[model samples]
Target: MAGSRVLFFEHTLSIKGFDKALEALDWMKEEMCKEKGFSRHDGGDYYDHLVATAQDLLDVGIKDEDIIIACLLHDSVEDVEGITVKMVAGRFGENVAHMVDLVTKKPGVDYKVGDNLKRYLEAISKHPGASLIKTADRIHNFGTLKNATPEKKLRQALETEKYFIPFFKTCRGAHPRYAKYFFRAKTTIEPHLWEIKEHYEEIEQLRDQLRKQERTA
Candidate 1:
């Protein structure tokens, strides 16, 4: 799996019923597949990430209907041109829509850079359920971080360390029911950061060695 062009998340467990949530998943899968602009960077289908994220939630024993639906559609408002918070509300109810909106980055702002990242994390902290969904999203994202450029992998791992680690810690306090799951997520993600950072360091070392050889020649 590590050598494959795309990494797949495999889980045998699935939740049944919740037809509306499944309906929302179908809707998101269709939209994500058709949208030429959306990029997964992991060389996998966008819908796979959504299902993996929702599965992460279920793995941690979070079976809330709205949160699950939010996990399925969290990126729709941001990535799909025609999808709106209002449209999501009309179809899946306000709770799902609201959580999705809360996690969606603001328009024209690069949520991964500068103060935008901080503000995005802060906004998500206001809603515990939204925070959990975001955490699950990150866990799945980083867990499958195989095909991205080394720079992206390093920067994102650093961001997760500096911002998301403490954010998860704080969430543990406010969301007692999810505390253990948050801890598990934190542990799961931290090791990836270390691995990426180490890989980056090794690359820099090789670059330095090559530069030295060129200079001596």
Candidate 2:
């Protein structure tokens, strides 16, 4: 099978009610296919990553169906417009939907992305399932930062190292079953993070040198 198709298949198998989640996944895939940009595509692909991470959770001994479903659908409501937790609940049942809702940021809140991210982290602190999905989402996102501009990449790496690293550490304390996957994901992305850090340091040193040259001139 093609890699994407294989991914989709694996994702479908991970859901508790395979047929129902497949129905929702098909709807999500269709909705996302009509959109433009890599981010949208990347966001849609989150379903696959979520499934893989769900398997990781199972490997670590997490046995809750709701938590697993929550991982699969966590980003669906947030990233796909017109999709809501109420709709998911109506279709999939309440517990799965509630977990998704807890992780979904409100639409059009007008805060800077950073502030919105902070709000998301705060919400996750109170919900272990939400935190698990958040960690999975971050891992997928961080793994893709090479597609962005150097400056943007640097900023993202710094944010991950500074904010998300510690956040995942706290998540470990609560959801130890998820910690290994979280740490593995973090480790996979650390090289990029360090690359960005080193690049930023180089730029700052150059800027300082330019200032000193101007003063000497």
Candidate 3:
């Protein structure tokens, strides 16, 4: 079972330039560990999540080594204190850092969470490479959202359906073959979201029943 699982994962990463991609993944694991989210991100194994995103990029024929490496480090500059674009450029080369910069949300911007999200939605047009990474990131986020709180699940699911789904559509236009599977894979999440939505209604109903019982008592 373990071997089969490894093969399943390996096949996905073997799209092209497998060795380099895998090495970049290793670098990501090492560098991401330096970020606080490495151990603390709500989703266990955020490093693995980025690896999955990198594989998604590879599967989409993103053979540009810089872009692949950028995919691996997409969150580092944002999540890691003192990890600036210049730092990334110094170490990873300008092209790789540029891609990471394109995706990293600017800090100190007072945009609300929803507004920041909106910024990403609007920014992707000017940065197609960043958009590719964002699409892959969103795929993993919504795909694994069962682990999120029901409220979180609903909020993220709605945001994804509203903003990220269209982002996926744009990416599909560029890489139709691979992007098709991304949306196909997300078919499961809709039901997952519905399930969470029902949980909310059920809780409200039970709360109402409790209030009526208390009033009677």
Candidate No. with top lDDT: 1
Candidate 3, residues 1-217, lDDT tens digits: the string is 3235334555666655456556656665666653644752354556777767777666656767776778888888888677789987887788778888878888687444777777766676355677677777777777776556667777876777666666666666765545655465457456765676787789999999999999999
lDDT of 1 at 207: 100
- Stretches of candidate 3 above 4 Å error? 1-23, 34-37, 40-44, 110-113, 173-182, 185-188
Task: Write down the TM-score for model 3.
Answer: 0.74
Model 2: lDDT of residue 69: 66
**Residues 72-137, model 1: lDDT tens digits:** 899999988989999999998999899999999878888667588888887887787899999988
* Candidates in descending TM-score order: 1, 2, 3
lDDT ranking of the models: 1, 3, 2
> RMSD in Å for candidate 2, one decimal?
3.8
User: Model 2: per-residue lDDT, tens digit, 1-217?
Assistant: 2246536555645554555655655554455443533132334444455555555555556666677667767767877777788898988899788788877777777434777777767778667777776776777667766666776787778788877887777777776766786677678778878877988899999999999999999
TM-score of every candidate relative to the true structure:
0.87, 0.75, 0.74
10 residues in a row with least lDDT, candidate 1: 2-11
